[model samples]
Target: MTGLLALAAFEQPMKRFAVLLGIGSTVCVVQGWTLAAMLFSLPFCVIWAYCGWLRTEPQLKWLNLMFAALYIYGLARHIWWTN
Candidate 1:
């Protein structure tokens, strides 16, 4: 994901927005604000992926699903089933 973001920096005009999402997610994860990140990233990535954004190769196509699952799991674990 970091790699993709780095690549986005080089070739994407939308990199600034992507960077916002990425950094926001990273900060939420580090701060254990899982639900906040999940709320932001799930919809963001889905839309970002569907719009042919990111400009990634075919091999990385499944990244959207992976990111969705990540947020789902994080929300479930951190917010729904908290310790």
Candidate 2:
């Protein structure tokens, strides 16, 4: 995710906006704001993945794939953590 963000920061014009949305969504989660974080985080995640898929570098492609796996793992962990 960080790798994707870094790449987006370099290449994408909307990177900053996406990052801001992520931060806001994180804050919402921390503040116990209902399901809004999940919704907000969705776009950031999608954009990250999209940007990663669009990357031309082989190393970045691998990194993106790893990041995506880790992201899914984190989501699964969160479900268990909350339960």
Candidate 3:
């Protein structure tokens, strides 16, 4: 009971945080902070992917998963190959 209550309490702030990160990621893109934006958006992509899976939304699931894979690959290449 207490655990469920705690989880419920924690859920909203995390959702809000994820949303802010998404918005901030877009703003980063607009401001030409491409790397920062991608970094911020990775979590958003992952979260949405999970949500899509839980809700059985195939389109959303696949799209987000694809983006997440691409973002991860790009980030890895940038971090490893560039150095």
- Model 1, position 29: C-alpha lDDT score: 80
Judged by lDDT, which candidate is best? 3
Error of 2 at 28 (Å): 0.5
User: What does candidate 3's lDDT look like per residue over 1-83, in tens digits?
Assistant: 34334445455566687799899999999999878988998998887776666557789989999999988987998888769
- Candidate 1, 31-65: lDDT as tens digits: 98868878778766654564344555443446776
**Whole-model Cα lDDT of every candidate shown, in order:** 0.66, 0.65, 0.80
TM-score result, candidate 3: 0.77
Off by over 4 Å in 3: 1-14
Per-candidate TM-score against the hidden true structure: 0.53, 0.52, 0.77
Cα RMSD of all models vs. native, in order, equals 7.7, 7.2, 4.1
Location of the lowest summed lDDT over 10 successive residues in candidate 3: 1-10
After TM-score superposition, the amount by which residue 30's alpha carbon in candidate 1 deviates from its true location, in angstroms, is 1.3
For model 3, what is the alpha-carbon lDDT of residue 70?
A: 89
* Top candidate (TM-score): 3
On the 0 to 100 scale, the lDDT of residue 57 in model 1 is: 47
